[model samples]
Target: MSAYSASPSTPRTTSRTPTPPRTTVVNVEEFEMDGRSIETKSADHVPIVFKANPFKHTYPILRHTCFGVQGKQTCEVRDTTTNPMFRDMEEDDPQIQYVAKPFRSKSVQKPYRLRCGVMNYAWGKQSTDSAVAQWMQEGDPTYQVEQRPYAELWVGTHTNAPSYMQESTGSSSNLVSENSSFANQSLHEFLQRNPATLGDAHTEQFGTDLPYLLKILSVATALSIQAHPEKSHAERLHASDPDHYPDPNHKPEAVVALSNYKAMCSFRPLPEIAHHLQTIDELRALVHEDMVERFVTVVGSDGSSVEAKKEALKSIYMELLLCDSARVQQSIDAMTARLRNSTDLSWVESTFLDLTVQYPGDGGCFQVFFLNLIELKPGEGLFLAANEPHAYIHGDAVEIMARSDNVVRAGLTPKFKDHKVMGEMLSYDTQPLHIFRPNNEGPLTSYCPPPEYPDFKLLRVSLTEEWPGVSYELGKSSGCLLVTQGSATLLYCGKDCTIPTARLEVSVGSAYFLPSRLSVYFSRMTDFVAFIGECQIRAG
Candidate 1:
């Protein structure tokens, strides 16, 4: 079922009953850009489409040399290698990387529809159960649901999953056939050619990359128990293990629930850990008696140094994690049997029994004791630190993370588990349960992420005809915007806001790459909502 297909609060632009295609287009939505309301008489712009060429084939499509909206119509034709944004993106002091040659093509920028990639990782949801799949279903008639697990919809450029814009010439979404693939160049490639579009701020801070990677994660089963290394550690690990670590960037991420979202994040609080360690015989039986005694003693003691307490926790966790694999399985079996026979129930007990079935005999079944369980209802959000051990248990969420794939596994996965590296990298510091809320108020809400990972930020923008417009000052960098509600239009300009650019109609499931360095005001919209992901580049 499409979660955003219909809601009482959301306004629909389509007709009540479906009919055959009409040649003429109707301009029903109003526009408010640059603070002035303009009546849209027509939508003369053509809808762009791209088709996949089955056999290895390349097409000569138009390339816009410009990055920002201002420069899209023209290009100064700067070399990408010398573009400072291209040079500074990675901290390794490399001159430039990832960008392919044939730098800038000679063509004017015309609006193109973005076509992102689909990730079918094993843990993903299947059929109608996938939010990623459902979002892809938007405006796509040829999208068919296969029985395979559809895990994530990648909306950024990270090599593993990069979105592409429509480069080929085509009519409307209706006219696009299966053979026509929309992706001509990866968004990363486009950014390399036009760094200005990302704006001065992002280019100066993170260079060519849009510091964050946005994804729609639809989980049918629990993800692997994992922790991402910090920047320095990431560089070291990547140097050691390039196959898995891939990028030297840290992966501090945030998740906004699309549906009821469940996850196991970080380690459990000390008090909770003590209670379970003492009460849960299954845990006590597995860890070293001395280590267990030490943890209980410190936690039981009144005054202990932060380092002392952390060290105690580290000892207990390592004992549990590195315990004999067979004994670990045995203890888990014991817990499951106890859970099945016992009448008393608890969240951990139930969760344990459930996940055990998903990943039978895995040590993570016992490792659950060392983690915090979190549930986020729709609209709720939370940030996950790079050092936090987290596993997405189930449910759907829109996730944004630093553009890195450097995950060190602990357990709960069929993939290789780097237990030693995970132990070294995991943050044992306990934290109280945290739920993210919009820090900035008004028509556009901003959920500020933690300072540790300042590469990316998120914004929730809402619009309506009555409150038709909301304005945001232009920053050095632009953002990646995804519309989740009603249709609307956006315009960017200076403070006087008199002269506006062409009205860009934003509809449901619509995604746009906003150029940097322009204040934007949205109008001609009602009950509209959207999420914007961008790099957090500070003004010097």
Candidate 2:
């Protein structure tokens, strides 16, 4: 049993290379099909072959079923071609005898190479400055870094920007295309045909596709201040206006910083907001005097329930969001002008001025005072639940979310704004954003979310010279892996008590689609760091 196995109860071994299966020998004569005669010295080496039908290219010419004979210690091979698509197939056929052995199914799941899509949004970091671009370039030699900004690298089966699986052929791998029988296929299409890859629990809950979308973001400027709708609200929005809503799925996302990162997330704590409201005269000027006084009074009251505080916060936020654009702009101009010459300024005040310069007169500038201004060092993370407003300010990060693109933007973007929806959809929870720290378990650092969010969880693998290897049990969920640094060799062992069936060299920016119910071993050649996004399987 390997020490890195997921559990002691499930003992498994690992090897640098695969062990060949034992074989039995039997004698057989040469067989001919479509004028092609294949000879074997003994039946032990005769291979089962399928030839493509010329007329019906989609269907194969022959199908064989082999069963072991008890007394003879050999196998009887029979043709079971019953498809109506095959023309002139004979029912009476001679059975060929051969040595029986364990047969592997063609439908068995294996790791697949992926070609992810890149988004070049204006807020993205430019070319080589962008981690998204650098990773994409490393994974794909064909990708060229242009002068344009590269914002995100999306890895999922979303129809908006689906990832394509590359088919390995001999020494080269090619992107699966429509013309090939099954070589080039979108991740969504492939999952439709092989739902088992998603695991039974995930497939039962989320259907054929992945419930989560993984992304690598490179932020040079601020993203739009936005909130995602809840499931029911998303369905309604998609039904009424799909042009903006796109998909009928809610997005609850989390981001793990890869560099020094900054963002505005959720609502500030009641006391914090109360303090800001009391001190920032310019922010207080945007909302009505009555609303501001009511918010401060409610927050300061010890008898107030959490629900009461939430209502108070919501009222204040809605007042600010619904304020006239001219009035909001006037307040922002006053605040920025006053803070410009101040020698001492709080982080929040500095962020407000920066946003003002980027998006002058935008209402999101005022939002800084209302939301928690969070700064995350590398590996630190925060979850933004559905209906919670957030906007990435700067830096690089890897993010995972419930598969959705439904964003209701209010400000700081040239994109369409839905101030009414944004105001109504916000949860207005005033708890300070909780920073997630990965729980270290050997070489694996797990960032598992609370049980309420069962869509996805992230695992970070760090391999150093001191601890050069690790094994991960895929259990009952499919996962996507992105190698962000250094190099390693992967040994893929599917199911339990099985030797590795495949071995591949992986390096920085290499990405793979790992199938469900497999154990994968990684041996580091150099320091390695990779992130795996898998469906969260709750334990009973």
Maximum-TM-score candidate: 2
Question: What is the Å distance of residue 5 in model 2 from its true position?
Answer: 7.2
Between which residue pairs do clashes occur in model 2? Answer: 176-184, 177-184
- Among all candidates shown, the one with the greatest lDDT: 2
**Local distance difference test, per candidate?**
0.66, 0.73
Structural similarity to truth (TM-score) of each candidate: 0.75, 0.78
Residue ranges of candidate 1 with Cα displaced over 4 Å: 1-112, 168-183, 438-442, 463-469, 491-497, 523-527
lDDT of 1 by residue, 1-540 (tens): 000111112332332211112111223222221211112211221111111112122111112211222211111222233444322233342332222122232322223356778889899999777877777776365788788889988778888878776543344332221213435766788789888777666777788877888878899899999999889999998898899889898898888887889899888879889988889898899887787788988987888888899889887787777888889888888888889998888887888898999999899877677788878986678888878888999998878889988889888998999888888777787877556764233456666686667878777776544344455544665677776667665644432222333445666655666666544545544677777787777747
Model 2, position 364, has a per-residue lDDT of 81
Clashes of 2: 2
Residue-level error in angstroms, candidate 1, position 203: 2.0
The residue ranges of model 2 lying beyond 4 angstroms of the native Cα positions read: 1-108, 169-181, 538-540
